[model samples]
Target chain A: MTDVASKEQKLSAEENISSKILTIYLIWSVIISVSIIIVGTILFIVTGKSGYNMENLNSLITAKGSLSTYPFYIQSIWSGVLTLKPFAIIQLGVLILLLTPFGRMLLQVFIFLYEKDTTFAIIALVVFAILLFSLYMVNILEALHIA
Target chain B: MIYIVIGYLMEILVASIAAGIIGALGGLGGGVLIVPFLTLYFHVPISLAIGASIVSVIATSSGSAAAYVRDKISNIRIGTFLVLFTTTGAILGAFIEHITPVKVLFFIFGIVLIISVIPMLKKIGEEVPNVERNDPLAEKLGLYGEYYDSVLKREVKYKVTGVKPGAAMMFMAGTISGLLGIGSGAFKVLAMDLAMRLPIKVSTTTSNFMIGVTAAASAGIYFFTGDVNPFIAAPVAIGVLLGAIIGTKILVRIRSSSVRKIFAVIILIVGLEMILRGAGVI
Candidate 1:
């Protein structure tokens, strides 16, 4: 509601024309991610199970830790999706949600370049670089055992 | 067996919905409500709870940011410019989160949540934002914009000052986002409203625009660290997103004055509980 208070305000042609691509993209990304999550949840319900084992969850509460010990990567989720594993489907949705903003930064780079706004393009690129670095930096460190 | 599963998932879903409603009504955020709920009632691990909370934060933000950005009330130049510091701090904060003890993280989250309640209590002063001489950096960068305010029924144009200080505060905001797995919009709005002195509407909208990007910086880190458990995150994200959508639909119909006060009190209580949880006093 903090930001939504401004929702009913009308946008001028200038504002509307410039931001159309991004506005549509953001809405779709949220829609797609949320829908996927819903599908995953339904799959979980029908099967009376999740991609994760009930035993794992039970153990998690008792162990005072987490159920996910496997190395974090996309391949596992892909394979799980191939089998229609419910929780894996959920993870795929989560992955999309995670990517939405990163993708926004990527989209902004193109938007800026298209507009020939060199300053903003560079700024977007810098933010993109930082976001990319944030996503993969820890992975890089762990791969080298430097972390 | 199916009913049992339904009931279990429903419990999380419903609690998340309640949190979402309160968050939406109060103009607060879900992460502050959720982390404590998951930890205290659901008994989820602190790390997993944070991971889930951050994911839901993105869900709620994306929906609102879409509207703000599309309206162009959010200044792309200023938002992206500040994002540099936020993303940088987010990366640093995520790494720090890995090293800090869970108890310490819990304690910090509690303190942050309590402090966040202050601005909400103050009632966002709709009075015009502070006007200052535009800094050369802001002028060069074009950190200025105008938006039509529906209530004021006029277009308000504004310039900002103190770019360096504002950027410094954004860095801290980003660090808090990465560290706590929350948006830290309070700090962000503080930086812009009190420090940078942008118009209130612009400050709030731009803060919305930046939150998703900032959270993504740390969320990606959480994903890679295996802190993002699908079971917890899936339900929480879905529930909060749905709840927020529902809240917005009813938002215009409801009077939020009394509701905001109640929710603020609830946030204070949750903050205390999180602190006690970290201190092992409860």
Candidate 2:
């Protein structure tokens, strides 16, 4: 009734700043997401044209056969025999960025009803970026046997 | 038939519904429900499933927290303070996960889940003091607020303290998140409700509000490390999100004490199973 409506209004007002930013971020994220799909498809097609066999490509993605290397902590049981595909790494990067700030923000605006402090919200976004970067680096290093 | 998309979407829808529902409940954190679904049902890789689960945890956190805030059930200032510690913990946990074995990581995670269920069964409807004297630290930290209680039919004011213990618990919660890829929902709620001793409602809302930021911090790393597969994550995230919303909506009406006990028992069984599997005993 009136109380519920008033409560909703008050809540929206409180979260106005964060909500606006979140909206902009969401739009940006969709663009990035579509781009990732396009790029992945193109990469897959071009790789196929270059005579990369679908069987090998699918296996690499499906984590069948020897996983080329331990990128993260757990390398799939398929490791020694199968040759590692280079495109998989780039695709993985694409997947990672797809879940980035823009992506996270897109989901957050739709999901959260609470108003977070703008400063804190911004900090959270930055921390998210850093965490992803670290993970990527860890995987890359592990793959290269650098670490 | 485009069955992959349909199957994927359907799976996500189910998980999201569950996460949403459980998240709305005061203490049944959404992460607990979502992770298992991803692992068992969809056959998602553990790392990717964990990544997706963490993201869904954030979604659940945001949805539930926002509702509670609108309802005037959460203490904002205190919640924010607790988030600072949990956020830091989440980052640390994500990095620590880089070094841990996946099987051992899951083993420990199941143990934590089992431990959390005990408290949820203890206090069903214990009313807390409305106006605790503001501790000096709480006063300085601005950890005081007022909320309207629906059951009591009045506005309730409270002062929050227990900074040291709250911070400690959040750190542990963060570690759990990093290691397990579960959202650490149960641990976060327990910390706020049991360790900080906030009202059940306040604890639940605040915990939900904070989880998204915490998960986001680590989920980024999860993605970059090639842990998030859209094919896998899409279904898992979507399912858990829908589930959590549904869970939250129905939470208040249900007799939660017995439900929580059952949930606890389920977690115990699952945890033991995972351990046995990991240990090669199963």
Q: Which candidate is the best by lDDT?
A: 1
What is the per-residue lDDT of model 1 for residues B1-282, given as tens digits with 9 covering 90 to 100?
567557767888898888776655443346768888888898888778878888988887787777667556678889899999988998888788877898898899889878867865776444456565788999998787787765566787898898999999999999998888877766777688778988655765687678888889998888877788777787889888777667645543544345446666887898898899889997
Question: Per-residue lDDT tens digits of candidate 2, residues A1-147?
Answer: 999989868865766554455445543443453344344334434444211222432232234112242232233311211233323432333344334443544344333434544544554455445544545655654585533
Error of 2 at B106 (Å): 2.3
What's the alpha carbon RMSD for model 2? 7.8
Lowest summed lDDT over 10 consecutive residues: which window, candidate 1 chain B? B251-260
Off by over 4 Å in 1: A1-14, A60-71, A140-147, B24-29, B119-126, B247-264
i-RMS values of the candidates, in order? Answer: 3.2, 6.8
Best-fitting candidate, scored by DockQ? 1
**On a 0 to 1 TM-score scale, where does candidate 1 land against the true structure?**
0.88
Candidate 2 CAPRI classification by DockQ: incorrect
At residue B227, what lDDT does model 1 achieve?
80
**How displaced is residue B228 in candidate 2, in Å?**
0.5
